[model samples]
Target: MESLVLTIPQVRKIVLEAAGLARKAQFGIGIEAVYRIIDHLGFVQLDTNYVVERAHHHVMAARIPDYQTEWLAELCEDGSIFEYFTSASGFLPMHDFRFTLPIKKAFKAQRKPLTQAETNLMKQILDRAEREESLTVGDFENDRVEASSGWWDWRLRAS
Candidate 1:
């Protein structure tokens, strides 16, 4: 096998093209455009931040000329995209949800064992999710839980 030498311009173009942030996205192509962009990008991080706009929106704006703040939300709400942790919490193509399973498994394995209270709370949340086909902390308003526990720490492994 022969090694092909690449020039600076060639590498730069490849990086930019993959990032999509520096490329011209399909203008007026609508939200389907975000699907395509994140497909190529692997995942787009969502941040609870605003410095002009949220990070995901800002990232999209750099690539997509006709981006809307609601577009990414719509993708997730409609299940066209699902949430995953890729370095940071991000939205990814729904078809790619399975790809995050390995990450979830690894994350689960390293988790500290659940306390009895935590275990019961998790069961209540899981049960509610199954019954309602949706869940939020509001569903568990009556159940006392530690206020400081991070949402990402939900997958408490049983001992």
Candidate 2:
């Protein structure tokens, strides 16, 4: 067997190319490009943390020119992609959906059993959903009378 050797810079170049970062617009910006990029990368970790922009959007914009943030939601809406936790929270190609089952099974096996109150709450929510043709967060009564302090807050800002 022969072992290949490469210098530090060469290895770095290879890694960058594989990650679609060796050049700008490595994949043309569009929905198709989004799918191709996700497929090639295997997974693009999702992050909700925002300083300037969300981590996931920053990633796409870096590698893809004219990247639109809405494309992610559109892909999800059309079932072209899905969000799941695989080592990390991220998006995966829909064709790879079956691969997630084992991870889900493992999580289910490892999780603590739900308490009676939690179980009842789950049943109640499920029943309500089944009976109602339409439901909204406003339908629920809670002590959240105050504005949310985190991401769930939907207060729009002036443009």
Candidate 3:
């Protein structure tokens, strides 16, 4: 039988290194570096608040010397990474997308079943997204009379 003990400093160093914060440029530079970092870390929380800069950008820039904010968008657009809720909202490597299925399932199970009208609205939104190639919440106006239902509710402007 054998056991190993770690000093406090040693444990702190280990945790920080695993989090990619033991030193600077841990993931190097450029968009490829961004992918590598996300793949290594598994998830990076995304924050839209920009008092100075977005939290996700700040996180990537701290470890990547040439990190650019646009790189995240580019990676997401190209399907190399994706943003979704997992404990918290964040970005995850595209390859890890399937691992989030359980979280999605749990969320759906806790919610009431969608009404037929809500289901129909969802189909309309999906169709619009397919036709438009891309869609954002702002793409639709707040014209729904049923009251904002949930996160997936898509508000459309009156035509």
Clashing pairs in model 1, backbone N/Cα/C closer than 3 A? none
| Residues 50-109 of candidate 1: C-alpha lDDT, one tens digit per residue | 667778888777777777878877988998898887678888889998878998899899
**CA RMSD of all predictions:** 7.4, 5.8, 5.1
Candidate 2 — what's its lDDT?
0.86
* Prediction-by-prediction clash tally: 0, 0, 0
User: Residue 17 CA error for candidate 3 (Å)?
Assistant: 1.6
TM-score of 1: 0.63
Across 10-78, the per-residue lDDT of candidate 3 in tens digits comes to: 999999899888988777779998998899999999886579998999888888887788999999999
Highest TM-score model number: 2
lDDT of 2 by residue, 1-159 (tens): 999999999999999999999987788767778888998997899986689999999889888888899998899999999999866799999999999899889899999999999999999888999999587656766555778789656544333
Better of 1 and 2 by TM-score: 2
Task: Sort every candidate by TM-score, greatest first.
Answer: 2, 3, 1
Better lDDT candidate (1, 3): 3
Candidate 3 Cα misplacement greater than 4 A, ranges: 106-159
lDDT of each: 0.76, 0.86, 0.87
- After TM-score superposition, the amount by which residue 81's alpha carbon in candidate 2 deviates from its true location, in angstroms, is 0.9
Off by over 4 Å in 2: 109-113, 120-159
